[model samples]
Target: MAPPLMTVIGAGDIAAEIDRHRPELTEVVRAAYLVHDAGDSSNPHSSFLRFPHRDRSRIISLPAYLGGEFEVAGNKWIASFPDNTRRGLPRASATLILNDCATGYPFACLESSIVSATRTAASAVLGAQTLLGTRRARRVGIVGTGLIARHVWRFLRELGWEIGGFRLFDLDPAAADRFGAAIGSAAGAADAEIVVADRVEDAFTDCDLVLLTTVAGEPHVHDPCLLAHHPVVLHLSLRDLAPELILAAQNFTDDVDHAVRERTSLHLTEQRTGNRDFIDGTLGDLLRGRRRRDPGRPAVFSPFGLGVLDLAVGQWVHDRVVAAGRGHRESGFFTGAED
Candidate 1:
């Protein structure tokens, strides 16, 4: 009605929409990856708008289109400022703009940071479960205890993955404490103890799953031997470990092109090896049985966090809310008259 009126979905509202469909989100992600693997989606390499002066801050634009039963198009504009954590602010925030493909008109705007983060967590956890062939991780170690880490914990728990022990490491010990408290309140069933590791290596020392979700520009974890335990690494931050570790692991990604372009560890690995043969296909490939994992080497999954995911999740949220008579609708968004 009335040009399908533009709707605004706030962050809280989006969260509510996601909460209502948490279980379905995983399946939605699976479908998105299946289409992506089948070459049915157009997920361009994300464009980064970095500041010369503000090296630690940048806004990324991920634009994509999904062509399948859930056909839709959208872009996610997300920004991350490392210093924001010092001021008690979220490091990353984003918005998704869903467009009408036929008319190329934006029909909805969604607070998309949640969608982005949740999709990422879902991907990481899904990989862990599928690759490990278990819903639970014996010990989960995280490099950064920020918003992403919290979301990952919640998702794992929701999937009924009993995290035997969680080791957290953040530059700010207070952040670690806070995270521990949050987990304690969320799911500390005696077996789920959150221990703040003073040293980053301690987090990696003995773990079944290791997650690197920090704000790093270049490689630091060099030894590569450090990951000798060969734990499944959910390389969410993209650029945390060194090329040697990347080369040492069986790599999987959401998109080969996008993940290899962002100066991530995999990018560095390509630079060091001078070839792309090391890349072991994508998460979609794994889920679709196109590839298999070898337990001999560490498994490192690096997802480029495609925009098609944002489009799918955003569309899902919009449809759910709208069907329930939600979302702030506004007509006459454009001032024009047809001749």
Candidate 2:
């Protein structure tokens, strides 16, 4: 006899399943912890696999332990290239492999590029709900017009937020127009309108929620003035916003310890200013109601994509497919029923 064979799915299938099962998937995220210092760094570092790339760069493996009704181990490989934009590609691309804890076998190997995008968006939405108080957010300002931005928009729409309109900006104005058109076409008035901006500052003005999902590695990309106006800012891409913006706010992270260890913009700021005190709370604290948001200070969320999220979502996909007899089962070893 042999351990069960895991089935792998592609990007499109995973994206569709993620859309259909977002709430359940997000619950998994809410339950998991962020793991940093996995011994690698492109952005959010984790330990698992580190493979070299075309230009002496490397793809780091991010693994996490997920416990509960769902028990499993998994890791996602993230490849980085600051020059990917030149080829019309994102700076990072990833793949996920879900493994069985009982047998230590690779059960499923799914294309996780889309998974990465959706989960990141889902986390941002969860963070907003936690920090901003769902009732308080009516409008959202999106600073990037890319894949991640599209996913975030859809997630917010699903939450039934009265999104008054969106302020869209991109290095490529044409890309911004294309994104606006797509959102307007699919969401109709639910998307309200897409307002294009000439600069990052123009986008943040008068918005209740601001989502920064750019590839910039510097802090000044997010002018203090821009963030000073927005009540809640979700730093989805880890370190896209300024340290000044972070220091000025009641900073909350998905995992404060992990954020610090990974040297995200939050960590860098702490190092530069010698002020680790800016960290106000973690998502777990807020979710568990152990901490409450202070209305006077601006709220910020910096979530480093956690492995538990991938495992949870992967488990969901795995179980559903397995129950339907959808994945291929190959023989290898069963050694014994009891060992």
Candidate 3:
């Protein structure tokens, strides 16, 4: 009998590999959604650990088992502290632990902030492609200028989305300026106009595509008129829109049950409306043709950040790292096998 080897993958290795395969990761995310929709996965509701006095800080545990082609089980433990930005640290950090399904033994541990952001960005890009039914947009607007927003922009650029320009808005004016500068300096964006928006409404006006990645705890954008352009909105951060706006749009989510909890905008919508009828379908439904987009109304995709997605992407990264001989492998991680 032999003990199962455990590999530790760090952030640098993960980032390098993922940066090279951003487009491919979109397919990975799509496949994970299909598998989960087929009932081949178990994704429990995320459990949040909150500090007594720190209302804006939370550590969440997302546990999942993805069957079918990816026979792996894992959990992503991630923390979000809004105040970390003041200390010159990223607001979110994470770790992923992957277990072999057959043996139920932990086989890999990976630094997962990159993994988390990668999957999230991949999902957002995929959602945009599917709902918008196009690889190009005349103009794109981003509401938050943070790590996830940056990743989404990179995925869009790497995937070769043709955009005429980008309008960026953030609560912090400096963050918006920095994000606009990054876009201005990027490789494919030299021809694209970058503007730092003076108001949040400016991010939605006349843009065919909009991204909401803010850290807002509750709904603030109460005006449904901001969506007059009827753009495909990627509500990535999950808490930025008001109930009226959610009800006014054609809503799609990663998982209805998951999204309609945690006091998310959709959750608040459900509470106010006392029904789930406003939700059009899951992203899987859209992928499988069970649901179709209504071109007459605004399209909004809200994903609850599925745990199976993290597992699927993490497993892929682990396999790729091991195949490349990049991760550090420990031979005697589990000692009881020799006994």
Candidate 4:
């Protein structure tokens, strides 16, 4: 006899599970330390499984260990392609697997697109809470309005900020509209006002908090002067800001090692300029009270999404599903080899 094969979840179920377990996930993210960087070339990429129905491309397997309250480990497999946008498909699709720590047995498999998005957003929210302090941010400027933007909006709403005064700008007009509508509807008690900006600069005007989520591949769109006057800026996408912007700001990353390994736009700028001292500290260090906030300089939070976040969130979702008897177990799925 062998251990039973567990049920596989789709994207919708995974998103719901993530929403349900978000609070616990937030605590896990706050405790995990950053992984060490091994250079850009050493960073892992995804593997592929093709299907004739979808004209298969690539699936990425990302794994990590988080040591803290949960004490668990897991990996996330993401299916992605730039072309998926044409068919109304997500550019990156993902699935997460959580394993039992003690025996290394398979625990549960769930959708990770939502888990990935929410964790990314929650990390930003956490950064804001730390860097921005209790100052009531009057305006929030968002540069991108894609999946990541959606969750960032959700988490910001949870933080009890006013959403009605949000300034949104995206390369796609329709995306900006969609994000505004969705955010406005979900925001409760907050006078949510969404404004569509004609240009990126228009979005940044007089905003106390700025979030850049573009895939522009370069930092030209983000003008340091625009943010110089702003209180706090969250550069969630690693490459969205220029090197000068990074050097000028009091930069902080979720993990110093992983930030460089991901070779995000920020990392590339640092390399191009031959300046590494621009990075002030890691988010983990700050959260652990090892690093202090600098009141004189503008704060920048750059998080190269971590695998540990997925593992912790995945474990939380799995436990909830199991408690509810939601996943079906397939017995004798894997047979042991004869000794």
Pick the TM-score winner.
3
lDDT computed for candidate 1 = 0.85
> lDDT per residue, candidate 4, 1-339, as tens digits?
246466666666666666645555666556544332211112233334666765535566777665545666678888767578888888887778776667666666777888788778888888887887762577889998988877876676655565337899998999899888887676382366679998988777877788888766456564678766745788887777777677778888866666864457667766887777778887767766778778777888888777776776676666766777676655554455353
Flag the better candidate by TM-score, 2 or 3.
3
Which of candidates 1 and 2 is the stronger one according to lDDT? 1
Number of the top candidate by lDDT?
A: 3
Error of 3 at 175 (Å): 1.4
Clashing pairs in 2: 1-333, 1-334, 2-333, 2-334, 6-107, 38-47
RMSD of 1: 1.6
Candidate 1 at 294: error in angstroms? 0.7
For each candidate, the alpha-carbon lDDT, in order, equals 0.85, 0.71, 0.93, 0.71
Weakest lDDT window of 10 consecutive positions for candidate 2: 34-43
Query: CA shift at 102, candidate 4, in angstroms?
Result: 3.1
lDDT of 2 by residue, 111-217 (tens): 77777776787888888887778734555677778878888878776766666778888888998899888878765444476688898776778887888887665
**lDDT, residue 211, model 3:** 96
What are the root-mean-square deviations of the candidates from the true structure over C-alphas?
1.6, 4.6, 1.2, 4.4
Where in model 3 is the C-alpha error above 4 Å? 336-339
lDDT of 4 at 295: 74
Model 3 / residue 167 / CA error / Å: 1.1
